[model samples]
Target chain A: MIDWLISGDRPRSVALGAVLLGILFSLAFAPFLFPGVRALDTAATILIFIVLVASYDLLLGYSGIVSFAHTMFFGLGAYGVALASIHMGPGWDALIVGALAGALSATVLAYAIGLFSLRVRAIFFAMITLAVASAVAVLVSQLFQLTGGEDGLTYRIPRALTPANRVGELFGVRINGRILAYYLLFFSCTALFLLLLRIVNSPFGRVLQSIRENDFRSEAIGYRVVAYRTAATCLSAAMAALAGSLYAIWLRYVGPDTTLSFEIMIDVLLMVVIGGMGTMYGAVIGATIFVLAQNYLQNLMGAASDATSALPLIPDLINPDRWLLWLGVLFVLSVYFFPTGIVGRLRAGR
Target chain B: MTQTLLETTDLTVRFGGHVAVDHVTCAFRAGELTAIVGPNGAGKTTYFNLISGQIGASAGSVRLLGQDITRMGVARRCAMGLGRAFQLTNLFPALSVLENVRLVIQARRGKGFNLFSIAASHVEMTTAALAVLERVKLGALRDQKVSELSHGNQRKLEVAMLIALDPQVYMFDEPTAGMSVDEAPVVLDLIAELKHDSDRTILLVEHKMDVIAKLADRIIVLHNGALVADGPPAEVIASDVVQKVYMGREIADV
Candidate 1:
């Protein structure tokens, strides 16, 4: 099993690298190590985004299908778990059932969307997904009685995952609910990432790449192009939904802004681009870099702003509040110079 | 009499005010190499597209092995043994040459939907794909990316993919469209070798008279979306109608 996990040169290295990164991130989140660092919650958020971005890459990078509706599926998964926990009363079993429900719903919805929209041209298909996703986002926000409107829904996870439940201690660190939740996110994300790696390396994945390169030729060669594409859509959606379920459990809440917002969709797209499209490792690297930047870069910029408050430059330009502006500039520069993403550049070097 | 393998009746396609493939009727007999010769915009490709189900016909019915397949899709036609190579070389550019051919072999072996197994680990598929590469004389370059190959080699790779399909009816639309003078004969010879099989029916669209002369058992001349002449090459070459419409003074002089 270990050998299989790190089989191919590039893929093996990538998988092993992901494992190492996961461990390092987990260690950073541990209470005993880096006690002054208060970024465990942020670290957990980055792990969830790894799963989400990788899932998105499965569609956009591997299959060459540009879908703006990915966040809708992500939102569905989160809401699924949230509603299930609220209705069934919080428990570990309820969380499992909710995750399953979310994944299933996302799969069904993806199938329908893929069937109807995949028949159209690529650009038209993208537009249709965008329109459908926007509509669903509005619908989720307006359903006050069930979805909690704009206020969102809050529910308890299993007691073991709550902050109040302290499991024990390990390596001079207290293993409480927060620590347990971090580890849970770590293992699940790693497993899902490996599964995606397996899928993209499989024969089915090869056909998807062929279709991506030339759909007409793929069809001409006797592959059912639409069916393969639809299958890819469903698989990617289910993975994204699973990530969303885990995300909701981690946050202990689900809301339109946090779950189904267009910003989340853009963030995923940015991650894929910055990490590199078509390389699975891009998702892992992209999410890590983006999340870290989103969390720490703002603080770093704020410190700079405090020291340079008397500068004659435009106040808005140097304002720490405009961290996103600096991030956007970095994103554009990365795309321009490293268009293939960080993984792509690394592969090219070797 | 040779059994009819494919038949097209009153096939027509109109682009609004223009008729691309006018009322045309034709038949491809089993075990014959038939070449469709025409000038640019003569609808040679549009005709291939209509019969191959690449485009919806304005009016016509296509029958393969005596079964009507006019409404069938491009993929269904391919599954039913109608293989087509595009005028422009179409292939998975990023994939290795062997992988490209293996995909076709995998499609034929009915393993396209197998998601669990690694594609390269399929011994049978790999062996068959390698055999095809050797036949096309692309064995040494099998590991090279398709994009790395020259235009002529890419054309051969395209034909190799068609060969992997082992289709009963083969359609080649300008297979040597952009090949160098020396490279054109390589593809022409490949077509001739396939034509040697009495069970295979080959329909090719060619501009080079030398290739058509060497391979065509019969010649069908299309001018402005209509069949103007059809017969043995010698007879068609002698026909004033073909000479006037297509062969012109230069081909006649040759």
Candidate 2:
């Protein structure tokens, strides 16, 4: 059963397996365990980032194709949800339609971009995606009425998905639309993660990995390197779009800053690298570590500053505002210590 | 001629006015092992590249079983039964030796695009891949990653992949280029076994005169991107022009 669940691709390390289970159980019962609004949001955000980063890994890790337009697909999904809510009214039907629309656009755009650039080479794919993503970001911010401009859009979903609509009281926690929404994200993300796991273990996934190892060899062996790379790009883009849809649905808001930011792309890259680039479980671990750090690192710094008030220059150096600097330090330390990322480190039994 | 399996017409390629391969035409046939021999800069490898679709021709066409395939890319040509093994041992280095061969079989079976098929559950495919691995005596190292394998082992894995491909035309660019003195015979024996099939067309590029004399039935010598000699191995080796251009001047230059 475990083999079927993970598609026979074990974590290959007892510690990694235990940590993954810890994460899974924690995420599965997040509301009951955490029971706070901010914590719930952070957990959901982590789940969303897991899907996004794993999708990107399909292109970069599996196929050796580096694309920078991941957020563009993510944004399209968000906007699809936003536009559907605003135009077609707040219904589950609208959500489905919006998600389908978003995924379709992302897939088509990815196919177009991949066909144009992937056939040429890797660097060209990266450059073209960066340019296209930037262009899309500018277009989203410029088209005020259509995409809500720079201010973004705020819309509503069904009452069962909001904070106030309490279904009942279970234990100390409120049984409300918010918890339902969280569960929705949880199940979807888990299914998506497992699906990705299955894909990487499939024959198609082998081809992609082979391409990463040696494209000329793959071609000589009868696999079309460009076609496989392009297919990977399209699939990754669509998955990112689905993730964006869930993100919009969770927040009930969509905007360039939230979904289309290039920073998010960089974060995804960092997460993929930090967790382990070539595995789906890497996304799970990397996104959890990163999202947790992003949220509570500031609090840790503020508390450190308070405790170190008597120290000279130390408090200022470790100030809450220097979280980004500390994050950089953390990234460097990880790359130094793990080299292949934490998952890789654990898998190697080191 | 047994059966013309592959033909090239005026096949040529230029690297910026430097004609790496001049207008050379030849036909490869079933039940024949043709050895392409050359001195340095004779374009033997370039001609292989042209026929295999690794590079576009400046002025030529490649016909496989009477189908024009000059414009087809590497993968397409491979799918059409044009199998090529490189001198450099191009292989998926991070994957297991079993997987490296299994992928070629999957590709030949048109199952490379399958998204949900568990590779291990494909019992027939696994057995077939294992059989191919055993052919090159890599069955024991099936689970070992190609990157970790020795250079000679990787070369053997390359031939395993080629055997799995089961192409009509088998092209080897110095199959024994980097093997040890002992390891060279394994690949040579495999090529000899394939040559016994009688319906398969084999093309080889080799610098080792001993290897050429042993495996190749026909020898085609290229000098400065042009065909200099074509006949039996003994005839070509003893030919006056080949003795002078290939053995004497080129040897002196080296």
lDDT of candidate 1 over B111-206, digit per residue (tens): 877866656667888899999988878999989999999988999899899999999999998898888888777778888889888888999998
- How close is chain B to the truth by TM-score, in each candidate? 0.97, 0.96
lDDT of 2 by residue, B1-254 (tens): 57999999888899997999888889889999999988878999899999988889999899998899999988889998899888887888888999988998899999988998677778888899999999899999999988899999988888888899999999998888788999888889999999998888999998888788888899998988988789998887878878887656532332
The sequence of per-residue lDDT tens digits that candidate 1 reaches over residues A1-350 is 65455323153355536655665555455456544325777778888898899999989999999999999999988998999999999988888999999999999999999999898888887998899999998898788899998999999888888879988888777778877787898789888887887788778888999999999999998988999999999999999999999999899999999999999999999999999898888887888889889888888887877787788775457678899889999999999999888887776755
**Model 1 bad stretches (over 4 Å):** A1-3, A6-37, A302-319
lDDT of 2 at B225: 94
Q: What is the lDDT for A88 in model 1?
A: 96
* Global lDDT scores for all candidate models: 0.87, 0.91
Q: What is the interface RMSD of candidate 1, in Å?
A: 1.4
Clash pairs (backbone) in predicted model 2? none
**Residue runs of model 2 more than 4 Å from their true location after superposition:** A310-313, B248-254
The candidate maximizing lDDT is: 2
- Per-candidate Cα RMSD to the true structure, in Å, reads 2.7, 2.0
